[model samples]
Target: MDLNSSSPQTIPVVSTFSSPFDQSPPVKDPNSASTRKPISLWPGMYHSPVTTALWEARSKIFEGLLDPPKDAPPQSELLTKTPSQSRTTILYNFSSDYILREQYRDPWNEVRIGKLLEDLDALAGTISVKHCSDDDSTTRPLLLVTASVDKIVLKKPISVDIDLKIVGAVIWVGRSSIEIQLDVIQPAKEESDDSEPVALTANFIFVARDSKTGKAAPVNRLSPETELEKFLFEEAEGRSNLRKRKRVGDRKEFENGEVNQLEALLAEGRIFCDMPALADRDSILLKDTCLENSLICQPQQRNIHGRIFGGFLMHRAFELAFSTAYTFAGLVPCFLEVDHVDFLRPVDVGDFLRFKSCVLYTELENPDQPLINVEVAAHVTRPEIRSSEVSNTFYFTFTLRPEAKATRNGFKIRKVVPATEEEARRILDRMDADA
Candidate 1:
């Protein structure tokens, strides 16, 4: 379905071949006698040199080995850029028998959502870099780090046999933060004028930091032009305010020991589950349904920014979450959405990272499709300092396919019961956030 088409005031419809921003550069013909090999032909080719330079500069500055360029433009010279100025469209022509397509295909012959997540993160970063740049290649670039993913919803399953387009642009910008909106679209067959069906939508939040001082850096302001642009800008503003208010509310709620009606009801349910005679046999303790994996952060997995790649962390977390759901339900679970992801801290190389996942809750309201909510927490542990910090938290929603459910005859997911107050609080927090 065309979500943007539903509203008259929505952003201008994106065309299949034309866009506000520059189109994808033409693919170089391999047969052409060129002294240089195309980056695509190389396995480990880094696509964006501008982004890589910025990341490397940031790392050097952090380590006190280099200083920010003296010729960097002053804040007064930063120009206000419109969303269209940085709007970008990247196409993945998987319909062709290309080598890259094979890497993104899953065992089911569908696009691997995990790999797509990684590409999305990379694309968002690229857009942010474009928005921050003043069209001057000589000046040093600001370090933009992914602060969090506001939301990512998959409206339709993606097929690997079709070409996919990723369109994104800066929707809003704060003094030191930027919000980017991205849409994953599948071009309509026959190339008609109809809007493409959006398979997914994601909003990513990034924070700008100075390469020299490692301090919050100012970014170009966003100037909304069309009615749709203005509306999206306002919507993003509201979401930002809501996030702030929610954070404050959470802190106060924890400090005051407040218990709402929903929390009280859930607490009662926990109490009931504690009683063997009254407990539901179809329920399982949340703690008892956990799966975990550990790995040392390696340099090879780092991003262009020289730290552990956010997408890599997401890929690992997602695999674990998927496995946890599969093991719990005894059926292959289909990913529904990434409710949200929070990057709490930067994970340095060589840090021992542990990914812990568990089934947070389940919804059996729809008999045909049982939904499972899984949460994965990425912790960076330093045994020498006896410190363990949560670097990232991911929430994924999955559901059983109808065919898989039908094959099981009477498959049912057990309700996840919180065994401790902490677990109960975690569930309540998630529920509250969703609400």
Candidate 2:
């Protein structure tokens, strides 16, 4: 499987058929009157499923991001690690010192002043971050606070933006709701005189979305997210989530590769077959007619950094499987899981690779969408001569998802088949119940 000596070519085998892919919508024109038109999403796409899976996996992805156990210890004497050192803490700062001013209300001139003082005391107790602080003062934890959209964004940049003027800001806990806080950090420098050199501080709370249809709008604070705030800013780490790494294998030589050339790689393909009978079949393929030029590869691809990158070959295999599945299903396919990968040989960057997919099973759980099971595989395509070495293989599950009409009940899977009978049999069964 090491691909050091020869060039490579990619072949796309599928047994399926499909209508032309509908193009994505054009970008909105700023000056056009049509700007008010509702934005429409692609009828069927795989991104939603991917997002759902990723969100579910968020905890594992960030497990190493922060120090654990935010709850108070039974006794203060038992503590060893500091609470403020956890990675999840966020910071907040406030500059305005105006007291909860109901002081100037018209009716509050004489007798009304006492009533106003009582009302103000009640308000402060209700709106302050005291709930986030330890009631017994037995435990002291770290605190990161934020209020206002700009503060958090300027501190930590995510992919999108939220309007601070309308919504404010907060620190997000794993799967939990976002919590807002109030806090300050003083400058490191000190003044030469006897006076204190600390700077002034300011903080604000976020406005909640009224309903799904309503955007957030800023308002005077009547309630603050205190309990959740303590968990996020005081109990968590001040750093970002950590990442994982993958290791690679050594490369092999590919001699006199013909199919490995870039000109021969397959683009995509389609065919026709029954919706049932896919699970038992082996070695699935695509209908050649729908495919274009075969993919090509050079010898340099085989010996990648002395060892080939197994991950890249996995991608190549997935591309072929998805393309073939898309043709048969007639819609975008979602990769639900990559159950396992067996790397029998190293794959260089230049080694041409071929791919195939077969339908495992499918059935209608609901009338508007069809659930299908697909299997994918990859192989080395260059250096035509053979030795004891075998082609590498991988396995993945895919759902050829459809855009169900709002009122429709179930989906109808399209007919797509590979050239061979055995391959066709494995990819036709449209059966399996929803989880």
Mark the 10 consecutive residues where model 2 has the least summed lDDT.
158-167
For candidate 2, what is the lDDT?
Answer: 0.30
Candidate 2 lands at a TM-score of: 0.30
Candidate 2 on 72-93: residue-level lDDT in tens? 3322232122222111211111
CA lDDT of 251 in candidate 1? 60
Residue 181 CA error for candidate 2 (Å)?
33
Top of the candidates by lDDT = 1
lDDT on C-alpha atoms for all candidate structures? 0.74, 0.30
Clashing pairs in 1: none
Superposing all C-alpha atoms, what RMSD in Å does each candidate have to the true structure?
A: 7.7, 27.3
Q: Which ten residues in a row have the lowest lDDT in candidate 1?
A: 6-15
